[model samples]
Target: MACFHPLTMMLTLVLAARLAAAVPFKNESYPLTTVPGERPWNPIEPLQQRLAYINATAMAVSWNTYTSLPDEEAVVYFGTDAWELDRTAPSRQSTFETSRTFSHHAILSGLEPGTEYHYRVAHTNCFGCSTIPTYSFTTALPAGDCTPYAVAIVADMGLMGPDGLTNSTGKGAGGALLDNETNTIQSMVQSLDAYEHIVHIGDLAYADYFLKASTQGFYGADNVLTNATSIVENYERLNEAWYDQITPLTSQRPYMVAVGNHESNCNNGGVKDKVNNISYTAQICMPGQTNFTAYAEHWNMPGRPGPSQNFWYSYDVGMVHYVVLSFETDLGEGLYGPDEVGGTGKQMSGPRGKTGEQIEWLRQDLAKVDRKKTPWVLAFGHRPWYVGIADAVCEPCRLAFEGILYENNVDLVLTGHDHVYSRSVPMFNHTADPAGYDNPRAPTYITNGLGGHYDGLDVLDSPLPANVAHGIDGVYGWSRLTFANATHMRHEFVAARNSSVLDEFWLVRAREEGTCVDGEEGHTGKDNGKGHGKGGKKDKRDVLARLDE
Candidate 1:
C-alpha cells in the first residue's frame, strides 16, 4: 500500500471531484431535485426527490428505497458544517406502500439559525441499505427582525364547474380533469378543491343555479378534505368536473391560506375528529393572536407560531406585513364565529376586526406601524366589498371595517367571496377616491376568488362607485401579487382558463409622506397615473411542481 502523503491527500480530493461531477449552485439557487430512477439496463438509480426542504433552523430531509431494509428504522444524518458524523439525528421508523410514491415528512427543528448545515439522508426500513448524502441548505434566519420571507397566495383553486372538465384535476391544464396529476401546490398546500366540488355538484346546490345561489356560500360542511381518499385522491375524485383546471401558479412560494366560505361550513363538518368547525380554517398561530374558544389541543394551531387563533395574525415576509383575516369569523352575527366561539355581548361582541380586541390590536398595530421598515401592509379575507354581482350585504365586513381601514390608513384590502375579478378604486368607507386621502395611497382592493371555482355571478352587479377601476366576470383564476421592494406593489388577475391577464391594477403609493386623497379617474388632483394596467415578469415560482418530483 502506498503511504498517503499530504500531497497525496490533495491528489485524492482532486480525483474524487473528477469522479463526482460536482453540481455547483445547489445550496445557492434552489429548485434542486434528485436524479432520475434507474432503467432496466442502468444500475438502480437514485429517486428524484431525495433530500426534502431543509431550512436554516430546520430540515425536512427524507429519502426512499426499492426494497425493505435489514434495519428497523430510517435515519437522517445532518450537521452544521459538512458531514460531522460525530453529532447526528435519527428519525422515527416509518413504512409506506411504495410504487413510485412513498414518503414521509420529517421536520427537523432546533437547528441553528443563519448557519450552514450539510448532511446525508438514509433509510433503514426493511431495505438493505440506501442513502443520499449530497443534500443541504443554510438554516433560516431567526423569526424576528431582518430575516427575509416570501409566501404563495391562492384562491378558488382545484375547483370543479361546468367548464366541462372531464377530469376534475385542476392541476395546471393537463393530467385530465381528474387524472393522475400530482400535487400542483406542493410548495404550499393550497387547493381549489372547493371549486372542484362546485363543479362536481354541477355548479349548483344540485344543478341549474346561477353564481348567486350556486357559488354563493358554496362552502359545504362535508369536510371534503376528510371524505377524499388522499389529497391527490380528492383531486382525482372530481376529475371529470375540473379535468383541465390549472393552478400551482404560486408554488415554490411559501404562502399561507385565507379561507373561502366555499372551503367548508358548520354543515361540512365531516372530519374523523368531531371538528369544532367543518371548515379547515388554518390558524397562522402568531403568539397573542388566538381565541382558543374552540377545542383544547386540535382546535389550537400546533407549534407556538406568531399569534392569534381564529384567523387574524400578522406575519413578516421581506419588508411586508401580511394580515390574513377570516371573513367567516365575525362580520356582525350571521357570518359565523363568536356565537359558537363567543361574541362581544355574547363573548367579546365581534371578531377581531369587527370586535374591540381586534380593533384595538389594529389601532395599536397601525399606531406602531413603521412604514420605514415594513413599507407594505396587505390584508386578505374571503369576502369582497364588490363582486360586480348586485347582492345585498355581500360585504358587511367592508362596511364595518372600511372605516377602521380608513382611520388606520390601511394600504390594501384583498377579498374573495363574490367569485368575480373586481379591482376597486382606492375607496374609503364606501367612498370612491383614488387619492387615498387617509394616507399616501388609498387602500386598494382586489377580489381573487377566481382560481377555477365554480364560475358564478359572471357579471358586474355591484354599485360601481366612480372609484371602481376595472372588473371581470366568470374568469376562473388567481391574483398575481408582485411585491417590488417596499414602496411599489402590483397585482393582476390571471385567468385560469387560458392563463391570460384578466383584470389588472396596482397600488402605487406616493413616496413623499403626507395624506393624499384618491378620487375617481377624473377629479383631476394629481398625476393621471396611467400606464400599462398590467405587464410584468412571471413569478419564477408561479406554478411550481408541487408533487413527488
Candidate 2:
C-alpha cells in the first residue's frame, strides 16, 4: 500500500473538482440601445437581426423587439447605398403565447439578382423614425447560373463568450461539452467572404437545456421545473444570448436552419400516467417549450403551402439546388411524427396527412430537379442515418427517405444530429461504392454535427460502419461546400480552433455538357485512405494565408 501526503491529496481533489464544476448558465442579454428620443415612450432597439433567402429577387429580414410597436411603425427601409435609403417594406409582428418579446419580419422584393442592398429595421411612424444600424446582404445569384460559390455548413452550434471562447464548462445530459464554439464562430467570421451564406442544419441554440447544471444534472432534472417563471425566463434569455452571439455572422449573411432534437421539445422528459402508462403531459413546459413554437416563430423560411413553411422547403443558390427537410415530424415513418416526440399533442392533419406529408413533398421536390441547370443537388436535415455512435443511428429516418433520395440520384446529403464530423463514400444500402467519389452511383453523406454545443462531444464507437470514409470526434468544427463548377464540388471539414483542414474531398461527376475538372489533383480525398487526417496541404495553406490577410 502507498501512502499519499495530505497536501498532495488536497491539491488533487481541488483540481478534480474544478474540472467537474458546472459553469452556471449566463443570463446575459444583447446590450441593445433604446430608440433615440427624450419622449417617455420609446421602443426597445431591434436585436437578433437575421436574413433568410426568400428568392432570387427577395430576402426576408427578421428581428426581435421587447416593446410592442404599432403595426404601422414596423417596417424596413432599404436602398443600394447606405445613405440614400429610398424604399420601405412593412413588417408583420408576431409572438408566441409565452413570449416576452415580439418578432418582426419584412420581405424586401423587386431587387436585382446578385446585387448588394443596404437595409435598416425601424419604427417609422408619422411622429418620427428610429432605425437600427444599416446592414447589407447580396441577393442570391440567378437560378441555373453555374457561378462558383461556397456555403458554410454548421449544426449543433451554441453560445460562446464575448471574446469568442467557451463560456460553459457544464457538459449537458448528452455528455457534450459547450466548448469549441468560440473557434467555430471565430473561424467563420475570419473567413466570412469565403462562403456566400451559412446552412445551420439543426440544433441552433440548445435553449431547451436551460436547466442543465452540475448539481441538478444535465437533463431536465424534475426538481428544477418547480419554478415555471424562472424556467421560461432562462430559456428565453439563453436563446436571446445565442442569437446575439451569432448576429455578427447571421446579420451579414443568410443563415438557413433546420429543426433538430434540441429544437423538438423543452425538457423533453414528460410525466406519464402511472396507472395506464399510455399518456404523458408536460407539466412545467411553457407554450414555446413544446413542439417547435420557438423555431417557427423565430424564422420565416421560404413559403410552402403546408402547416408550416419552416418544416420543408427548397431553394437554389448558384449551381446547387438546396432542399431542407424535417426529421422531427412528417417523415413517412419515424419515432418523431405527429404528437409523437416533440409534438404539441395535436395532429397535423390536412391536405397532407401527418406521417407521409414531408416524404411525399420531398419526392416531388427531388423529381422536379433539372440536372443541366443546377448540376449539384444537396439535401440537409437534422437527424442522420450514418454516424460515429451506433446507438444514435436513426434507422427510421434512413428507411423513410433513403429510397427516394437514392432513386433521384441526389448528389450530396448533409446532416447534423450525432455531434461529430463524418463523411461517407458515395454508396447505397450500407455498401461502399467501389468507384469512390469519381462519378459514384449514389449520393455522398456528410454528418457535420460537431458544431459546438452543450454536450461536450460524442464518443465514437469502435469498428465504424463500412460506408464511412472519414469520421472525427472531440473537435469543434464545421463543413464548407464549394461548388467550383458544373461538374466539380469540394467539401472540407475545418477545425474551429485554428481553421485547419481536418479532412478534404471532392465529388467529381460529368455533367451533360461538361466534364469533371481536377481542381486539386493530388488532394482529391482523405490522405492515405484514412479519415480526419490532414490533407489538401496547399489549399489549407491558402485558406490560412487568406485569414491572415
Candidate 3:
C-alpha cells in the first residue's frame, strides 16, 4: 500500500471537492469554456408538434427548425375541411440558446368547441420546400358537457432509435439503449386513438443525461470542449428524433405537459437566459417561468392570461377540471438549498426569477372550482408527494402542498418522478382515510412516472406502507383515465410490450360523495365485478389488441 503526506492528502481532497462543485454532472467532464462558431445542425423540415388546447376557443401550435429563414413569420392554415383552408394564424419565432435551434409558436383562436378542425403549419422562410400533410384535432367540450373521454398520462419518456425503441445508451450519436422498456412511449403514440389527449407529467427527452455524460467523458477521461459540443449536438439530434417519434400523435391530438426536474434547465442556470426557457416554452407553453427567456414570447396558455406562464392553471375537459402545477419550481417547501444533488438548486425570487407563488396560486385556483360545472377535479405535477421508494419520498412537498389538494376536494393527484407506478389509497396527512377509498375525505395519489427512460424502473424499498394499494416495477407502461361519465372514471395501467393492464381502479362520483373502487391485484383487464376486490387474486389478463380500431 502507498501512503501520502498529510498535506498532500488534504490538497487532493480539496481539489476533488472543487471539481464536484463546479459542474452539475460530477461524473461527466464538460467544458467550462465555450466553443465559438460551432452550432449543431439538423436537416429535418419544420413540422408542428406539441399541440396544446389553451382553451376551448384556442389551440397553441409549436415546432422547431435548425435552418433559419430570416425576416419570415411562422403561420398555420386551417378550416373545418382539409382542402378548403379558411384561416391563417401567424406565429412569432423564438430560440432558447444561440447554438440550439429556433422554435415557432402560434395560437389559433376563435374555434368552435367539440368540433374537429384540419390544420397545417408552414414556415415563412421555407417557401422552396414542399408542403406537409394536413392534420386534424378536436377542440375540448365545455365543462358539464358529460362527454365520455380518455387521456393518456405519462412522464420521463426518453428518445427512440432505429429499432423504434429507446436509443441505446452510449457516448455520442445512437448510444446504447439503457432500458428495454423503450416501446412504451411509441406504443402510447401508436395507441393514440384510445386517448383524447396526452398529459405528459414531465421529463420528456432525457437529453440532460446525454449532456451530463458527454460533458464529462463517459469513462472519466477528462475530455472538455469536444465532449461539451457533443453534448449539445447529441441533445439536438435526440430532440429531432423525439420530435419525429411524437409528431404522429401530437400533431393530431392535444399534448399537454408539465415541467420536471429534467426540464428545469438547471444546467444553464434556471430560465436565466434564452437557452433555458426557449425549448420548454416552445413545446408546452407552461407557466411559472415567464421572463428571462422566450417562454412569455412563444406560448399562450389559458387562465389569467397576461403572464401566468401556465405554471398553475386549470382547464376543463369534459366534466373534469385538469389543474397543472409546477412542483419543479420552489413550491413553498424548503426543498431548494445550496447543496443540490445536481446543478445549482432552483433559485428563490431574484432578478428575472419567480418564487413563493404556487401555494397562493393554488389556494385561489382551487377556491374557484365549481363542482357543479366540473364535477371531477384532477391535479398533475412533476414530482410525487408520496412514494414507497426510500430516496424518492418527498414528504416535505406533501407537507407543503397536499393539504391544499385535500382541502380543495381534489379527486386525484397524478404525478411522475419515481419511474415506477404506485397507487395510494385515498390519503390525508400521511394517514389513509378511514373510509378506505370509499367516499374518503382525502385524495387518491397515483405515481405513474414509468413512461420509459434510460434510468430504468426504480426498485421497491422495504416495508411498503399500508396506504399503497398497488405498486409495480420492471414494467414500462402509461395510465389511461377514461371519464366514462360525470359519475365514473376508470384508471388503467397498460403494459407497453404485451398491452396487458397491470392495475386498475374506478372512481365513482355520486351526487352525495365520491367512492373509490379498487380493482383486483394482477386482475388482467377483465370484468371483476364493480372493479372492487377484497382479497388478492391472480388471473390471466386480455390484450387490448390495438387502440386505433
**Model 2, global lDDT:** 0.68
Candidates sorted by lDDT, best first: 2, 3, 1
- How do all models score by TM-score? 0.51, 0.79, 0.74
Once fitted onto the true fold, the runs of candidate 2 whose alpha carbons sit more than 4 angstroms away are: 1-43, 126-131, 162-168, 171-181, 214-225, 270-282, 333-353, 514-549
Taking all chains together, the TM-score of candidate 3 against the true structure is 0.74
Regions more than 4 Å wrong, model 3: 1-44, 68-72, 124-128, 162-182, 211-228, 266-300, 303-308, 333-353, 512-549
lDDT of 1 by residue, 84-104 (tens): 533445543233221222232
What is the clash count of model 1?
Answer: 85
Q: What is the C-alpha RMSD of each candidate to the true structure, in Å?
A: 14.5, 12.5, 15.6
Q: Residue 93, candidate 3: how far off, in angstroms?
A: 1.5
| Per-residue lDDT value at 24 in model 3 | 20
lDDT of 3 by residue, 1-549 (tens): 011235534543544455444322212122211111122222324543568888767888886655553424557787776666688887766665522556677788988765677776665444434224456787776655554567899887765443223444333333234444336755675576677788888776654444344332341244323233544554444444565456666777888876665654323232212222222211121222222233333334565644346556778875688998766554564554211232133422222124556677789888988776677899998787666675676655676678889888898999988878888888887788887556667888999887876545676665666678788877778999887655667789988766678898887656434221211121112122322111122111111222222
Where's the lowest-lDDT run of ten residues in candidate 3?
Answer: 534-543
